[model samples]
Every structure is written in C-alpha cells, then in structure tokens.
Target: MPLVAPTTIQKVSGESQVEVPDLLAVEEPLEIRLGFGPTSNRQQKSVSVTMRTPGNDEELAMGFLFTEGIIHQPADIVSCRHCVQDAQKEGNVLRVELHPDVIVDWSRLERNTFTSSSCGLCGKATIEAVRALTPGPLASEFAVDAAILHSLAERVREAQLAFAYTGGIHAAALFDANGKLVLVREDIGRHNALDKLIGAAFWQNWLPMGQFGVFLSGRIGMELVQKSWMAGVPLLAAVGAPSSLAVQMAQEAQMTLAGFVRNERFNLYSEPARVRLAQMV
Candidate 1:
C-alpha cells in the first residue's frame, strides 16, 4: 500500500480523445536518522535517510540493519519504532534501538551514507569495498533440489497481486525447507521488495534462514544476493537473469543461486551440488 504514488498520464485514442489515470508506483526517498543502543552509549550517528513505499516500514528498517551486519541475532534488537510519535510528522522515518551490549562498529556504519531502492550499493567506494564488507559465505550444508527451485518461481509469481493489478511492481518471497511459501512483499523497486520481505521475517524472528530459500520476481543481482546471504539464506531463486557479480558472490558465499526460473526450468548459477535434479524425476 505504501508503494502507491500519484501521477498523471495521458491516454490518447485514435481520433483525439484523451484520458488521465492516476498511476501507482513504489515510493522512494531518503530516511536519514540515527540508531541507538539502549545499554551502551554507542549509536549510529547522522544516518542517511532514504524514501520508500510506506508499507512494512518496520521490516524495511530491520532488514536494512541485518543486511548491513548491524545486528546478528534478533535479540540484539531491543526495539524498532517510528522516530516520530505523531503520524503526520513520521511520514517515512523509523528509529531502531538495539541492546546495549551489541557491538556498534563505526567503520562499517560509514559505508552507508546514501541508499537507493534501485541500487543497494549506492555509497560504496569500490568493488574491493564490497569484497571487504561481504559477510562470511553461507555454509554448504543445506540441500535444495532443482525442482524446488523451479516451483518457487511459480509460487512467487502467483503471489504477486500488486503486479496483477498495476503490472508494475516487484515481489520477494521466502519459502520454508519444504518449499512452502512463508512470506511475501511487493514494491516498485526490487531492492525495496526484498527489504520489506526481510523486515517481515525479522519482525517474525526469522533470521539466519539456513533452512529456507528466497525467491524474487525479477532478476537476481549482487544486492539481492547480499541481502539473502546476510539473512543466512542458503538458496536464492529469481524469475529472470542473474548479474555476473551476483553469480560470483553466490559462488563465493556457497549459496545456491538460480535464475530464469519459469515453467519448471531454471538456470543454476552456484552450489549446484545442493540442487538434486533427480528429485524431480
């Protein structure tokens, strides 16, 4: 619901008739604020703000924190709430408070000076910067069959209600070990969709998804891979292509990455060993 935006469009007919319809789109903006820990004096000072669709904002904040390695466990987060008490003033701001003993690394916090829905790595200095910040690669103990990967793509597509109505939103979904869809979120920006999904999982105390898989309604990119890895999800499936960097990161992280998932077929990019093709046979 927060993804809707007001826009005017002209519809022209063959003769000369014109019509205008309000357009819906995922909202994007800067949400600058600071993160505080209840017990310690440390806090993320002068954090950059980014605008986003208004729905599931709590999840977005939590997911962002998790992906950025700000907090490892759900318990580390003491609380997350709107920065402003008044609804009218808190339009897009959220404040995340962590437990006092939780580690607050200033060096890592400086990297995220600016963020955008389209590009998650908006403020990084270099490719090396990404490599340096990469979380440990996922352990290769999880098993995900090719059939399950194929099935997940269909499930993600089926869950896309907003796209059905507006034909212009992306979706992100999480599935259990058995490939049953657990949660899903949609937004105009692919990154925001994933963030919302992550936020939802965080709120539900579903971190370190070692036994779960992530499915995306669009292409799998480096940012998507990074988010899944940060959440400890061992597998990622996308309906479209995988960027070259995404493939590289998945391989390095030991995550099972799949793309072009449709109609019972998909391309596996990394950790194919975990995908049992014969399971379908």
Candidate 2:
C-alpha cells in the first residue's frame, strides 16, 4: 500500500477555482490479531482495528502491544506478519505470534480492542489504569540544553517526508541528548506515529529509552504521555499545548514535558530540571 495517493482536487483562491492534481496521505484500517497461548492450544483473536497509513504495520503492531501491556519486549514476539486470509485483506490484517510462554490476559484486551487511529485506547477510564502498567518515576540525570530542545521541532519538520507531500500527516521523532535526530515515523494518526517510533526502538531492543527525548508534531495528550512513559523516555516535547491530564501524568512520572515548542520558546510543564536554561526566567 502506498503511503500517499494522487488525487485531483479543486484549488480555490478568491473566487478562482481550478482542478489540479495533489497528493494525500493514505489512511487504512489495520486489524491487529494476537496469536498466543500454549503451543498445544493456540488462540487467535483480533485485538485491535486502527485506521492508519499502510506502512510500518509491524512496528505499529509491536508498539501498540507494548504500550497496551500485551507484550513486554521484542523477544516475547515470535513473529509479526501480514495474515492474508483473503486477497482483499492482504495488507489490512496483521497477525502477531507471541511466544508460547507469554501469558495473555484476554479480558484486558477485549476492553480496549476497539480503537481508532485518531483516539487511542478510548475506553481507558482512569489515570491509575495507565499507572499500573507504567514504571516508577524516572530518576535518570539525562538533561538537554534549552537551546538544543528548541531546534527539535524543526528537525522533525525537515524529516517529515509524508507531511511535506500531503500536509496532513503527524510525526513522532526520537532525538539524542544533543538534539540529533535518531529516527522518525509519520502517520495520519498522531498516536500511530508515536507507536511506530516506539516500535522501531523496541525492535532495536531499546526499551526503557531513558537516554533519549521524544518530539511530537502536535499537542501532547495523556495517551501520548503514557506511551512515552512506557518506553522510559524522560523528555517529551511537542509543537502544541498539552492537556491537563498529560501534565499531571508527566509530573507524576518525573518526566520532562515541553509544549508549544517553537519560535525559540516553549513551556516546560513538568520536570523543568531536566532542561537547562542559561538564565532562569
């Protein structure tokens, strides 16, 4: 499946309208199926169905599983592949095989399985639910200069190839303490983008990403904070404002949360100590 599709649209400007060719970010539904249980008694069930761009299905699946507390590490996954039961469902269905030793709590998944790419983990009722899966407060001394943090948004913008073409994609990027771009993932859904980024790191066995920072191309929501915290990322910066719950969660986790990061300025909502400023404001 192509990440972008060509379409003809009406270009209107001050009563002037013309049909022109344009590019659009592709969005498709990806059904994530889990195959777990003892080898003698294997079980397969559709865990989630999210509308997302077609690329990075495996990463998205793995990341989703990890964030949702289904699988802890990459080793827990035996394999992730497209399950093409029918030609029509070739790229839309993905089956993840977990090690037989991996114990699955199906009841938990059933309660959160129906998710959209836009709204992640929709049925989550309380912050404590997330806290149960998240680790303790981040105690790492990892910090970055304020000036370096200011440049992270531009770095993500430069690397957002899909956003450049469609102007409708969201991005999540991982950066080192020096503000160097490590990797980026783009999707129509912001949550999916972050999942893809986390999944990539998970595949590399980079769980508990305490040494790096995560940058979002949009507002920081509670779910985003939860995902970052699950990955053990200490710092999360975003181009837009954050929700009240997001700040609360970040503060509780001792994670640095920066929002509205642009124009040489940003708001540090929590763990300000992790960001060094030349002169305190």
Best by lDDT: 2
Q: Enumerate residue pairs that collide in model 2.
A: none
1-281, model 2: which lDDT tens digit per residue?
A: 99999999999999999999999999999999989999999999898899999999999999999988888988899999998777988899999999999999766565543232232443234455667788888887889999998888887899999999999999999999888899999999999999999999999999899999999999988889889988999999999999877887788889999999999999999999999989958
TM-score of each: 0.80, 0.93
Give the runs in model 2 whose Cα sits over 4 Å from its true position: 110-125, 279-281
Backbone collision count in every prediction? 11, 0
For candidate 2, the per-residue lDDT at 19 reads 97
What residue runs in model 1 are displaced by over 4 Å at the alpha carbon?
A: 5-8, 12-23, 28-32, 37-44, 85-89, 112-135, 279-281
What is the lDDT, from 0 to 100, of the residue 179 in candidate 1?
75
Candidate 1 residue-wise lDDT, 188-269, digit = tens? 7788889888878877777777878888989987778878877788988888999766776677778998898898888888
- Estimate the lDDT of model 2: 0.89
Error of 2 at 112 (Å): 5.9
